[model samples]
Target: MNTQYTDSKIRRFTIFKRLLNYEHLSYQQLSEEYFVSRSSIANDISYIKKQFAKEDLSLTFDNSGTFFNGNEIQVQKLMKRVILQREEVMDIDNLLMNQIANVFHEAIEKREIDIPESHIENIVLSIYLIIFRSKQGYTIKLDGKNQLGRLFFEFDKYPIVYDLLKEVEKCGIYHFSTDEAQHLTYLIVGSGLRFFLKDEKIPFSFRDRIAILIQKVSEGLRVNLTQDNRLEEDLVVHLYQLFLRTDAQTTIVNPLISEIKQTYPSLFGVVWFALSDFCKPYQINLSDDEVGFVAIHFQAAVERLKKKNKILFVCPNGIGTSSYVSAKIRRILPDINSIETVSTSKLKSMDLSDVDFIISTVMISEQRKPVVTISPMVTSKDMKKIMNYYIDLIIYNEQKITEKFEFSYETRELIGKDIIFGNFSTKKDALDYLFKRQDFSDELLKEDFISSVWEREKLQSTYFDNGFAVPHGNPAFVEKTAISILILDKAIPWGNQMVDVIVLLLIREEDVEKVEPVMNLIMQGIEDKEWFISKMMEVRE
Candidate 1:
C-alpha cells in the first residue's frame, strides 16, 4: 500500500467512505483515480486510519483492497450518525423508514394493526434485525408444542403478520417462517405508540391493575396522578412489551439509567416498591434498566403536574441572539410560561414583578430578584444555572405548601417518649401492640375503629415518603384525641412502602381540625428524611 499523500483531509474521508462501500479497490487503482502516486495513496490511507482510530473505528488493507474492520452494530451506528448529521440527507434520506412505512400503511389503514408515529423507528429496527438474522439462518420452532410458542401460534396466521413478511421478502433474498413473522408482529404491536391515540382499548384486568399502580404511587408521593391518561397508556404499552421480553429472556439497554437513578432517587424508590411484586408473576428479575425507563415516564408526568413559571430574558447582544436564547430556555424548561427580553439599559426599568426569575447575558448591577447570567448562545453552564435554580425553587415551594399546616402546639400529648413503640412487624402486629398499650372505652370498639383502620389500609396504603405511615380512623370512631408514635425495630414492608416510623392519630370527634397540621409535620419529615429516620430509629423506650 502507499505510504505518502497530499495534505487533504476531505479527500481522505472520501477515500474512507469508498473503502467502506467497496472492498475491490486496489492501491494502484486508488492512486491513479486520485491523481496521486502509490506512496501518496498509502499516506492518504494512513491519514484515514488515524481519523478512524479517533472514532473507535479500524481499517485493514489486504490483497483485495481496504476493509473496514469493526463490530457491525457499532459500524451501523456510526454510519447512521454520519448519514443523518454530516451528509444531512444527501445520502439515505430516511429511505429505510419509507420502505417499512409502505408495508405498515395498509395494515394500519385497514385497522388490522395500529402503529404510532413515535415508534416507527422501533418497527424499522425490529424488521431490520429479524431479516438480518433470518438471512443468517436463525430459526425458532413455530408449532405450539410449548407454552411460549402458543403466543406466536395465535398470531402467525393473522393477515397483518403475513402481509409484513411478504413485504419484507421483497427487500431481501431470505424468506421468513410464519413463527418468525409472528414474533415481529408481537414486537411491533407491543412496542408501538398507538396508545397515544387513546383509541386502543387494553384488557379490563390490565387497566385496573395500572390504575391501582398509579393511584398507590400517587398516594405514596402525595400527588394527584390519576388524570394523566398518557402515563397509563404508555405503561400499558411498556409493560406488555416487558412481559414478552421477559418470556424471551432478553435484556434492554437503557442509556439514561445512571442519570435517572441520580436525578430521581425517591421516585425510583417509589417505582421499585410499586412494581416489585408485579414482576413476581412472570418470575423475572426487575432490572435497573427497566426501572430507569419507568422512572422517566413518571418524571415527565410529575413535571407536567408542576406549576409553570414566567421568566424574563435580559440580552444586551440584540434580538436575534435573544430569540435563540429564548428558544433554548423553552427547550430545556417547558415549565416556562413566557419570557420577555430587555436590553441592559432597560434592565432596571423592566416590569419584573410578574416574572419568576431573570436570565441575563450580563450581570445586573442591582440584585432585586434571582438572576442567572450566561453567554447569549446558551451552553451547558447555562443549563446548570437554570436547572439548579429551579431545583432550589422546587424545594422552597414544597416547604411553602407545607407551611399552612404547621402551627405551634405545646401539647405534644400523644407524642411523648412513653407512647413510642420500638418493635413491630406486620400491620396486624403493629395494631395489636398499640391496642395492648392502651385501654380504650367501649364506645370506640362499638364503632369498630380498629376494623375500620384495617379495612381502609386494604383499599389504599397511608404510607407516604420518609418511611412514615400515617394511619387513622374517622373521628367518630375514636374515643380519645391522641397522637401515638410507633417506631419499628427495623423497616417492615407496608403495602408497597417500607415503614420504620408509624404515626398513629386518635383524634376525638370534635377535635378533627388537627389532621392537616399533623400531615404538615410529615412533610417536614420528608424535607430531612435521613435525619427524621435517624431520630425515629434512635428513640429509646
Candidate 2:
C-alpha cells in the first residue's frame, strides 16, 4: 500500500487548509490555489474518502451542502497540527504565519497563563493558525460533542481571550466566530503545562477525582496504588489537558503509541481497563492514542517504583568538581538509591562488594566492578552513556519476566566455536547468509527459523548496543539447541541500534535454562565492544 498518510497533502498544508474550511471549494479553485491539477485534487479527495469509512469520518459533496459530515472541531484540531508543522518550510507564507504566531506569544506573556515555556509557543502557534483560518473566510464551527469540559465559557474569561485576538484583528482580517475564541481559550487554559508551571500542590477537587480514578484503576488492574503520589499527580495533570483537547476535538497523534504498547503491554492493558468505562461524562470511548498517552505517566511511575541501585562515584579530581559530578548524577538519575563520593585512595582501602557501579573522572587501569569513565562536568553524550548503563542494570535486575527474557553470565555451555565472522549490510542478508551455514535438525525447517527471527525483531529489536543483536525465534521452532554468531563487516542498522555482531541463539524449549548464560556474556561482550571485536577477529583468522 503506497498510502502517503491518509491526510496527505498535494501541497504542504494547502490541501487541508481548503478542504477543512466551512466553505466548499471547487476542484478548479483548489488546483489553482495549490498549483496542482484538478485531477490531482480529485485523487486527493478519493484517497481521503477511502479512509473516512474506516476512520469513522464522513464527507458529503452534494446539494445537501458540501462539507465533511463529521466532527468539524476534530478537523480543526487536525488543521492546527498541520499548519504548525509547516514552520519547517522556508516560504513567504510560512514567514507570515510565524509572525502571526508572535502576536499570540506576546499576549500569553502578558496574561501569564501558567503554562510551561515549552508549550506556550505551541499554543501560540495553534491560536495563530486558528485566526489565519478564520480570516481566510472560514467560520470555525462547533460540530462535535463537547466531551472535554461541560463549562464552555464565562464572560470574564472570554473577554481576555478577545483582547488576545485584538492584535490579529487590527490588521483588517476577517471577523472570526465567537466559537473560535472559546476554542482558543480552552486550548490555552487546558494545556498540561498549566499544572507544572504554577504550584507543586494540585487542587483538591481535581486531586480527589484523580484519587478515585486511581482507585477505580486499581480495582481494574487489581493492583493497590492508593497512595502513589507521583502516579496521582501525573494523572491529574494529564487528564486536565486531555479534557480540553477532547472538548475541542483536538487530535493528538502520539508517535510512541506502538512502541509504548509493545514495551509496556501489561501497563497499557491496565490503563485501557481503567479508562474504558471511567471517562463516560466525556461522551466518547477513549482512543488508543489517548490511552497510550496516559500509559506513559503510569510507565514513569512504575520505573520510579523500581529498587534504586547504589552508585559510588570515584573521581580522582579534587572534591570541588567531584561533588559537582555527584550532584549532576543525582539530579539526572533520581531513581538512584544513593550516591557515594570516594577518593581513589579511599576506593583502594574500601570494599566494593556493596557497590552497584563505579564512576570515575580519571581512568583507574585496575579497579572493581563496571567502571564508567566520565568527565567531571558531564556532557550530553556522557549522560547518554550513564543513562544506558543505569537502565541496563535496572532491566537486568528485573528477573520476574524470566520466560520472556532469560540470560546467563556463566559461559560454560552457551558460546564457543559457534562464533563466525562475516561481511554484510542488511539484517535479512546477514541472517540469511549466516543461518544457511548452520546445520539444523531434520525436523527444523530453515524458513521457519528465519521467519521466527523476523517476528521477534518486529516485537522488539533484539539489538543491545555497541554493535550486537541477539535475534532468536520461539523455542517451538527449534529442534536442537545450538548457537551461531555472525560478525558483520560493518555495523548494520537494527531498529535504533546499529549492529556488527549477530548472536543467533537456537535454544530448544528444553535447553533454555542451560543456554540462558550466553545472554550475559553476549551483553558483556557488547559493552566492552573494542576488546570483544579484537578477540573475535583473532578467531576469524
Candidate 3:
C-alpha cells in the first residue's frame, strides 16, 4: 500500500544492486557514498545479508569488503528475486520490458518460434536481466557436465531457437555468447514453446507415455477418459512442453494453481499422484505449477464430458407465471439447454425420464427426479437456492464417484484427539510436530513417511489459500488413515501462501477412495474459515 519508499529501503536497494554486480564496499565507503552514518550503512548491509540468506546464499566479509558468495546462475537468480521484490524501488524500465515482449510476439507471429502466453513475461524478464547484467560485464557461463549445460553446449541442435536468439540480439543490442544464447533458448523452448519442422517427428513412445498418464488417472477417478481423443491430443502437446521445462529445470509459475487446487481438490490430488507416477520412470520432477496446468486440461475434459441439464418446470397457478419463471431461469443459467413448462395437472402425465431435475412453483410429491420449489416470482433467495442446486448438480455430474460425500459417523471418527493448537514459525516445524504426534504402525517406516511428505512438498506445496495446509506423504508409507489437524496461533508461510490451519492427511492404499470426501470437507472449511476455525476451537475444548 505504501508506494513511497523510505530512505532505508532506497539505500538497501542501491546496496543490493551493487552487491549483485559483485561489488565489495566497506561500511565507511558506503556511508560516505550514500551520505549516511556508518551505523546506517551497517544496517543496510545487515538487511542485504538477510535477503541473501533467504535465497540460501551467504554474504562474506573479508579485508576488501562484504560480497555475495555465489556463481553466475545463483547471482542471476538472486537478482531476479530482488528485482521482483523491489520492483517499485528499482523503478524497472517499462519500455525495456515491453520492447522485449514485442520481440517475442513478433517471433511467435512470424512462426520463427512458439511459446505459451503465460511464459512470455518470464522470457521478457529473463532477457531484461540478461541485458542489464551483461552490460555490466557479468555473463552467464554454463557448466559442461549437467544435463542443461550439455543441452546448452549443443544449442545448434535447436536451429529454431538459435535463429530466435539472433533476432533477440538485435533487440538487446548485445551479441550473446554460446552460453547466453543457449540459456535464452532453453527458456524460450521450456516455457511451452513448440518447434515445428516439416521433417520433424513426434516419437510414438511419447504418446504412449501420455496414454499411460490418462489411464492411471482414469482408473483412480473411475472415469473413462481414455476414449476422449481431444484429451489425448491436448495432453500429448502439454506433456512435451512439460518434458522440455523439466529437462531445463525451469517451470512457468501457474497463477491459478491455488484456485485449481481449491476448487477441484480431489481432481488436483489425483492428477498430482498420477503425474508423479508418470514422471518417475523418466526421472523427471515437476513443480506443482506444472501439475496445476495439467489438471486444467483434465478438468476441461471433465467439463466437456458433463451432460447439460434439462429442467422441467411445473406451475399449477397459470401459464403466464410459468413462462416468466422459465425465461428468468434461462437468463440466470445459460448452461441448461432444455426447459419444459407444464401445469401441475399435465406434470404427472409428462415423461420425467429426460428431465434431470424439476423446478416447481408448488410442492410436488416425490417424483423420481430431484425437485426444487421456488416462488412464482423468483426472489434473490430463490435465485441463490437455484444456483446452489445447479452447482451441486454440475459437480455431481462432473464427478459421479464423489456422490456420497456427506459428513457421517466415520468422517467424525477420522478427526479425534490429534487436534493440536500451537505456534510454528515455519512449515517444517508444523510438519515435524504433526508427524511426531502420529502413531506409526510396525509396517510403516518413519523415514520413508517423512521423505515422501517432503518429496511431495518439493513437487508442489500443500498450502491452500484458505489459511490451511493439507500435507500428506505417499499413501504407501501409511498403514492406516488419519487426519491430524494443527491450528496455528499465528499464520506461517507454508509455501507461496500463509497457513493458519495445518491438516496432515495420512492414508493407506486401500483408503484411496476417501481422498475426495476428505478434501471436500477441507474445501468446505476453507469457504468459511472463521466458522471452521471456531468449530476447530470447540473440538479442542
Winning candidate number (lDDT): 3
Q: What TM-score, computed on C-alpha atoms, does each candidate reach?
A: 0.42, 0.51, 0.67
The lDDT of each candidate is: 0.61, 0.63, 0.73
lDDT per residue (tens digit) for residues 163-209 in model 2: 76776677554355777777766776566444333533445766677
Residue 368 in candidate 3, Cα distance off native in Å: 11
Root mean square deviation (Cα) for candidate 3: 7.2
Write candidate 3's Cα lDDT for 298-320 as tens digits: 98888788777899988877778
Off by over 4 Å in 3: 1-71, 74-87, 94-104, 112-114, 144-156, 170-172, 197-227, 246-291, 313-336, 339-345, 350-408, 422-471, 486-502, 520-533, 537-541
TM-score of 2: 0.51
Per-residue lDDT tens digits for candidate 1, residues 1-541, read 2333243555566676666554556779877776777887788877665544423346766887777754433343344334323443223425654666676665466655555554455456555544543444444333443243343224533455466567667765347766566555555545543532244355677677778778756764667888999999878777766665444333344667665644555566567555643444333445556777887888789988976788888888877898899998888888777888888787777767767888888877866789888887688988889988978877887656434222343334335544464777787788767755654778547348777666556644566545777676654677767777777778886764567878776766455334434544555565566655554444423
Error of 1 at 430 (Å): 26
Identify the superior model by TM-score, candidate 2 or candidate 3.
3
